[model samples]
Target: MYTANNIADFFLGRYAAEGKITPMKLIKLVYIAHGWYLGLTGKALIDENPEAWKYGPVIPSVYHSYKHFKNSPIRCEHDSEVTTGSEIIDKFLDRIWKVYGKYTGTQLSAKTHMPGTPWDITWNDLKDRNRSSLQILETDIKEHYQQLASKNANG
Candidate 1:
């Protein structure tokens, strides 16, 4: 399994040339990549569990790392020197890029907020209602992504 930063950097590296990767988009992309990796291979792509924030599910480290950039496109000083060091992981990220790379950060954020998404489930299920920091369980994420894969495969 890789750290969330590793995955974040990988996405950053891939999009450095494209100039549309934002903190929000990078967080969603990394989260989606983790879910697909876990759902498909039954292995986590990143070690961190994403928290349900008002905006959506967020990995804290990745969020903090790029928050300084705010709504603008991220141009990190060290941008994109990431390598997951697993051939399968690399191939999988490439696939994710091909599938999701077209959308902007706002578009990706809306996708995460969609009904029945893991972020939506975890965010709404909260009784204590922190609304900004509750962690979305890995099991919930895995099952959700697995269901998506199944639904897509069937249709």
Candidate 2:
């Protein structure tokens, strides 16, 4: 597994060259990659779990790293740096970018906040608890994506 920043760097380097990538969009993409990769490989795509924040699931590290950009597009900072030592993982991430790279931050946020999504369930269940953030369980994330994959396969 790679650090969320490593994945962020990869995306920034490869996909955001000519594209606008806000912090929210980058964060959501990383979370999505973690979910699908975990579900399919039964292993983590990132080194950490996401926390359920008001808008949706967030990788705190990536969020903090890019928060300064606010709604602005962050410049790509990666320069051929190695990320996720495995080529298979790199290819899988490429696939994720191919599918979701076009979505705006709001669109990706809406996807993650959809009913029964891990962030939705966790946030709805715990938002009133007076906590700043709640951890979105990896198990729940895995199951949700697994079910999604199964549904897509069946359809």
Clashes per model (N, Cα, C within 3 A) = 0, 0
lDDT of each candidate versus the true structure:
0.85, 0.89
Residue 41 alpha-carbon offset, candidate 1, angstroms:
1.5
- In candidate 2, what residue range of length 10 has the lowest lDDT sum? 76-85
Model 2: lDDT equals 0.89
Q: Over the stretch 33-129, how does candidate 2's per-residue lDDT look in tens digits?
A: 9999988888988998899989999999999999999999988656654456788888988899889999999999999999999998889977565
Candidate 1 lDDT over residue span 54-145, tens digit each: 98989999999889999888885444545678777888998988888898888988988999888888888777554454888888889999
Candidate maximizing lDDT = 2
Pairs in clash, predicted candidate 2: none
All candidates: CA RMSD in angstroms? 2.5, 2.2
